[model samples]
Target: MQTSKSTTRIISISFFTLALLGCQSAYYGALEKVGIHKRDVMVSRVESANETQLEAKQQFQTALQKFKSVRQFNGGNLENIYETLNDEYETSAALADKINSRINDIESVSDALFEEWEKELSEYTSESLKQKSAQQLTKTKSQYRRLIRAMKNAETSMKPVLNVFKDQVLFLKHNLNAQAIASLKGELNNIESNVATLIKQMNKSIDEANQFIKTMSQ
Candidate 1:
């Protein structure tokens, strides 16, 4: 059983690589051949997206701390500060991009699953069972709407935060002096507010993901 599961995992991963490269049809076909369906893909993608959001939350928290540290700068080597801040900005941007990609992946899988579910409803010969399954699909679709909206809200919130980070980094690149640090100090409050809002939205998105995962498990 272990070896069988391991082989399945390898095949699934290989197919996922192909899927990521714009071969989603092939990916779904391969998975279906292995007894894996779009519903399973949705569950897996949601789980991954949840983990990625958690990671982004932590990364943004660190960025907030870095911003705070820069605001309190009474330092000698300001270039070192610029370098560190630049690195944080780059990492945060990369994370924002990753979260967006995950959101897209979740949407893709959800679309395929829900479309298949809606289509398969007609295949049921028994009316009562068909009605029940149809209602379940409706409920699941509603929950997914809430989840994706929250995910998108969080994903969009990252942009303003990234803009602030980028502006500060660019400003410091040309003017690495006390005056530049003073300017950063002025913008620090806005940065804090934006990061706080971003974190709040991420928490909401994460909570939605957890609820969706429960629905999937059921």
Candidate 2:
């Protein structure tokens, strides 16, 4: 009975592996039909990630500006300030989510591309060509690791800033009065520092991404 079960499992595994390979072959074929390769997809994903970081930076800056503007609220529609703060919080949260998704997409394509590159290196007939390709693969992989580390570091830096923003937004939401405004004023300096740090990390990540893209293109 155990032998039969093992045989059944082996067959199932073989079928699944064949199906996966067939699907991947079809996917690559379609991509080639449109002049898109895995390398192109990876580059595009990196660019998309950079763009998302840029957008996120802008959104955070806008939120900070709005927060500062609210500090000067001596009178008039407090509701407007609340609405703006809430909007900023929601928008920033959404941008963070998008940035994270872009990072994941980049990672997915990167793993597939690197795996394919490694596998193809073994298929090269000429020793010289294989050696060269292997060196290039090693270098590319090293560069990619650095680039991804920078990107992930930047992504990690954003969390604390976002948390602070959320807390302030929630506090203000619950206490929409002069006291709340006064309390927020106390947090301004810390928020500014966190935002600055976040922006620096983002800029570093962007530079790393651009460098990686240029290297890959070469």
Provide the TM-score for each candidate, comma-separated. 0.88, 0.86
After best superposition, candidate 1 residue 97: deviation in angstroms? 0.4
lDDT by residue (1-218, candidate 2, tens digit) is 25698899999999998897678768866997999998898999999999999999999999989888866777887778888888998999999999999988888788778988999988999999999999998998998998889888888888888888888888878888888788788888989999899899999999999999999898
**Candidate 2 Cα misplacement greater than 4 A, ranges:** 1-26
Q: After superposition, how far is residue 211 of candidate 2 from its true place, in Å?
A: 0.6
Q: Which ten residues in a row have the lowest lDDT in candidate 2?
A: 20-29
Error of 1 at 132 (Å): 0.6
The lowest-lDDT stretch of 10 consecutive residues in candidate 1 is: 17-26
